[model samples]
Target: MKSLFVTIVSLFSLSAAYAQTWSVDKAHSRAGFTVTHNLLAEVDGNFKTFDAKITAAKPDLSDAVFEFTADVNSISTDNERRDNHLKSPDFFDAAKFPTLTFKSTSFKKVEGKKYKITGDLTMHGVTKPITLDATMTGPVMMKGMGGKEQEKAGFKINSTLKRSDFSVGTIPVVVVSDEVEIKVNGEFAKQDGAVAEKK
Candidate 1:
């Protein structure tokens, strides 16, 4: 019994030592979306403020966990009037729901560098499960601010969601397409000495 207990503890410690945390480099990251307008053209927009993090134990990030949050007020479409209208009650009501968030429940590899991430997205006080397709690039070692070697990775994630699912807007589908295409590109830097144990 004693030997078995020691063996289990040793294995646990080894697993914990492999876990790492990577933080988004906001300067090189962007969260944006596109939606069709009146069947004529597509409107593009993006959120100016957002943050995300990833935790994993493997180099391939097959068991990674992702968490993200974006400030609703930071939304921008280049037009002040339209942006303001989006913040009103007819749309996001940013004052009441200040932020949108997502936390991954599963991260599975579909092929080389491609993954499917399923998570719960919370927006406008509604929480729903959503899946996103992601492509991951290098956890390459690069020189950093102090000329020290740092590990960096890149990700491109995409998804399509319905605005009505989150009670986001009251506009008719004919005026604005119901399907919104989301695109997120980010570069993450692995934190030094940040150990993240698996739950």
Candidate 2:
């Protein structure tokens, strides 16, 4: 009985040692998308307001948990009219559904520094499964502005989703391509505590 108790305690301690919570540095992160417009050129857009975090229980990120959200109203395309239209009922309808979110279900290491992340993406009041090819770099410790040691990590992820799958717009595919390519570039800092630090 004593031996069993010791083994259990040791396992618990090991688990705790491997767990880390990372807070997204929004200032250094971006979530963007691209789609073909009129079959002539690609239109690029980005969400200005967003948040994301990661809870990694393993060093290789095989058991990492990811959560992300972006404000639909913050979408920008560098064109005022197009941006406004995106906020209208013809597209995202920001007034009704103001946020798009993603929650990761699985993060599996596929190769060195590469992972397959599967998650549910919710947008325009619709939820669909999406998979991203992710490359993670560095949980390396470095000195911060004040010379305090900090741990940081970054990820570059790409995924393709059908706009119609989420019912994003009523426009025809010829005008705005049905397929959208998403890119997420994120930099995260280790949380000082269990909760993320507010900027």
lDDT of 2 by residue, 1-199 (tens): 9999999988866666667888899888999999999989999999999999898766555678899999999999999999999999999999999999999999988889999999999999999989999999987998989999998999999999998999889899899999999999999988775432233
- List ranges where model 2 is wrong by over 4 Å: 1-18, 194-199
Best by TM-score: 1
**Per-residue lDDT of candidate 1, residues 72-184 (tens digit):** 89999999999998888888899999899999999988899999999999998999999999999998999989899988999999999999999989899889988999999
Q: lDDT per model, in order?
A: 0.91, 0.90
Using lDDT as the measure, the top candidate is 1
In model 1, pairs of residues that clash are: none
